[model samples]
Target: MVCLRCVMVVKEELNKLGYHYISVVLGEAEVIEDISAGQHEQLRTALLKSGLELMDDKKSILIQKIKNVIIELVHHSEDPLTVNFSEYLSQQLHYDYTYLANLFSEVQGTTIEKFLIAHKIERVKELLVYNELNLTEIAYRMHYSSVAHLSAQFKKVTGLTPSHFKQLKDKRRSMLDEM
Candidate 1:
């Protein structure tokens, strides 16, 4: 789960299965009661019907949590930290940065820093499409050190300078759903 709507869907599925949940966040949930195997299976089927899957393995669950945290910070949060991405991730996930970085790279086949840059570039595309924030402001909001840095990264990732990308307004920006 990476958005509020996803949380809503999960909550609705849990309720439909007669399960009580205290809260449903992006990647974690606190249920009121322990469910039996049959109920768990039913809930899993319902979630799958809604295009969601129940993650059961510990490593997979942790990876999902890491993804959720990054997604939330990059695309949803209003006031993100000014700190380094690794430090932010370490604090948010409550794990040593090195261990988390190694696990992320091993499981996802990409370094966490690269993953973050991809997500950040995607967010920059969205903001450019919206035309609400100027490049400098977008850079600041996205935690880039400067507009030049943001533009360089954007061009490197998308093969077009920010201004060039903005000029071709008809280009389709990728959706979070597709990411």
Candidate 2:
């Protein structure tokens, strides 16, 4: 689950199954009652049918947690991080950065840096479509060193300059899950 609507869907499905959830956050949930084996299978099947999966493997769960952290940072947080992203991730997930990076690359077939860049670029696209902030402000919000750097990355990823992209008739942005 990467967005509020996804959370809502998960909650709806859980309620339909008559489970009382204590909380449902991105990529995780806790129900008041212990889940039986059959209930667990039912929940897994229901989530899968709704385009969500109940991940059980440790590696897969860790990968999803990493993705969730990045998504929350890029899409939900307003303030930039005080520390480096690597350090923040290490502290948040309670694992060494190297281990996390290697596991992410091994499971997702992409480095964590590239994955973060992709999500950041998607957020940039969203801001451009909204037309609420200029490039410099976006750079600041996104923790880029400068506007030029942001523009170069935006062009490299999208094949168009920021200004050109903004002028596009159909501004395309990827869904968070797709990213």
Which candidate has the highest lDDT of all? 2
Model 2 agreement with the true structure over 61-136: per-residue lDDT tens digits: 8998999999999999889889999999999999999999999999899999999999999999999888899999
Error of 1 at 144 (Å): 0.2
lDDT of 2: 0.92
Worst 10 residues of 2 by lDDT: 169-178
lDDT of 1 by residue, 1-179 (tens): 88889999999888887888898999888899998898888888899999999988998888898898888888987784877888988889899999988998999999888988999999999999899999989998888889999999999999999999987864445443356
Q: In candidate 1, which residue pairs clash?
A: none
User: What lDDT score belongs to each candidate, Candidate 1 first?
Assistant: 0.88, 0.92
What residue runs in model 1 are displaced by over 4 Å at the alpha carbon? 170-179
Candidate 1 minimal-lDDT segment of 10 residues: 170-179
RMSD value for candidate 1: 5.0
